[model samples]
Target: MLRGAYLILAGTVIALPLTPEGLADGPWWPAPAVTGTSSGERYHAVEPRLADIIERREKAWKAAAAQDYDRLQHRSARLNRLLDSAIGVLVEGEATRARRQIRDLEDDLRTQTGELARLRTALVNAPASGCADSGGSLVQDVKCALMPDARTSLQADIRAVERRVAELRAERTRLLSDLTGSLQALGIALPASDLEALLVLVSADRLIDTYAAYRSLAQVNAALIRAAEAADGDIEVLKRYYGFHVVLVEICLHLHEAFLEEIEGKWLPRLAVLRSEAEAAGQQARRLLAREDAPELRARLSANVDANGLSIQAADLYAEHLRDQARTATERWAGLYRRHQVALNTYRTVALQGDVLSVMRQSNRGFAELVRLELPPLRDFESTALRDAVAELSERLRLSKL
Candidate 1:
């Protein structure tokens, strides 16, 4: 029942719909990617982030294969330090300076624009934020970057983002509630369980990238305050949040590779067992049905096997679908590196993470019909001998998830 992507978060299974179609309902902003050149050209340059991605990919995948998910996630924060140092060494100083030149110029323009707006507001009560509203590609980015009091504007923007995130949570809760209600209506009657909470929190930190999208703005503000050698509480706050974003980016990049092994080493095997058991049950039911002459008995036996059989197929398809999702995300990542690689987007790619979550959220609607189908009560089965055994098997499959 997946429309997008999903994952096993700290042993908790989550349904992530990160699909293009789902993005229509969300905000999507992507950083522009630059193309590469031949020998010492654009695309060929060594990117520290790319190298770190390879390293983290290798290490993280090893851990995930061993089923150490908690450790895998906790250690991601350390990679931020490792990555920063790596950039200082792997990437050329001149290239970085050159890249920042354009970014700096944009910052300057925004600063001047904000200043003019401030003057206008002082002379004539033109809306204090009106100038900021007209500031950049994204209004909040500009406001947080240059307009008004740094602390006030930044905090307000942060609050606004928090509100949006809250709304997303509410919407998700309702979606899950509706899903359960729909399932009950369809006769599955899913039990109230912890999986619903696990599923809801699956995308909890999704908006970290959105905060990082304000990276330039926040950084510029922090840098100015630092230059003045003045104390700013928001300075530490901004640093902590930005640092957190870096950790997440590193983790996500590695996950694009490591999580695939998680699927192979853990998830697929569970599904294989389910499918195998279901297949056997189908065989047994078929044999029993063939020997029975009552039409009613025949229908119940056939329906149980057929319904449960479809659940197994749906689960299997979802498992394979997750593998494909990780592979696709990896391919997109390969675009960023130098080897065999296409030159890809700037660091601002992190800002566009909401869309990535949207992509993960996409999945086949059929998965909506419980991947492990809740078979009708076993008492309805014709044969008394195999009914208990088959019922137990059905329950086991029903509880299984990727």
Candidate 2:
């Protein structure tokens, strides 16, 4: 009976309005204690700012849905800070419950922020015309203006998020549970509860940042296109489908270009640098090719081939594949050779005062000596390959002509 009375008394004390500073022992009273006249008045006072934060968060979320990544990022950052400030002032008891709610909002914000950072990084580093969407231009894209059925599907996604968010807000303890559940349904494994604490502090607007939503939109657009293609009846729907397809293709092409740049700039060059060590390895290859035809050379080539465990096709395609690889290498090397030639010419003509002897000397530098020692066979290999590709490509062309 005494324990029950104490529980009732505790509840009653928690329900009362917070007095001025020193009365409540903190800057703000907890949600559980926000019942009496003063607390209600205080809640009403701050409610408008909280509501504004909510509005900003929603706008950011919508902008992200529309692929307005820039606006989404800006608004998301603003919302997060505001939410943090609002949640900071509450008293401990009911405050803990409010904090739990705040944690949910922050987690969404942090996730969105991470997503925003990824999108921005992609845009910044993306090849060509850079920014995917500037000042809502991407919103003008056909994919954003989906047909009625597609729009209906998107609305369903929005409603699902809204419903989930509402359920979390209804009971503070369910916030993390709701998020974990949603992620699981999406086939995403969330971090452990302790790790999730960091995410919980993120601002409201940031909730829209790391955009799983755009990817979702793209998926929906693709599905709608498939559906329309199956029907093949509605002209209007077909038009929308084609428009969306064009946008998808354009974005895909840009992504491909970015990929190509990475290969060209980073990966392909490493291959060249490795192969440069063998650039003049052609004399050695010729000897091997000749030996393939010669009894002694054939013996050596066959023995070496066996020792290396290389396929027999290496010999059969030896000249052909070597030619192909060499041609590609030379086409690339030509760019470097051209730059070097220009530098040599500039030194010879401009610095050496047009002396042909000086130009020859410039051509045969210490670098040539290094090449002589290190890669004497490379140039020879390249020359042999070039001769072969010309013959092969010419044969193909001649056959085509025939």
Specify the highest-lDDT model's number.
1
Separately for all candidates shown, the number of backbone clashes (residues 3 or more apart, or on different chains) is 25, 23
- Scored by CA lDDT, what does every candidate get? 0.37, 0.33
Candidate 1 C-alpha error for residue 57, in Å: 14
lDDT of 2 by residue, 96-164 (tens): 333345454545754555555555555455444212243466544444445323334444555665565
Q: Please give the lDDT score for candidate 1.
A: 0.37
For model 1, the stretches where C-alpha displacement exceeds 4 angstroms are: 1-249, 336-402
Per-residue lDDT over 1-402 for candidate 1, one digit per residue giving the tens place of the 0 to 100 score: 111222221111232222101011112222223243221232123233434554554344323242223333355665645543432222222222222332343335445555545554454533355444554667667655565654355445556545555554555455556545533432235454532321221111121121122222222222322322332334443232222223333433433333344445444576578777778888888899989899999999999788667655555554554455445445633431221111012112212342322211221122433233232221122233334334333334335665
How many clashing residue pairs are found in candidate 2? 23
Which candidate wins on TM-score? Answer: 1
Worst 10 residues of 2 by lDDT: 10-19
**TM-score, each model?**
0.31, 0.21
**How many clashes show up in model 1?**
25
- How large is the C-alpha RMSD of every model relative to the true structure? 26.5, 36.7
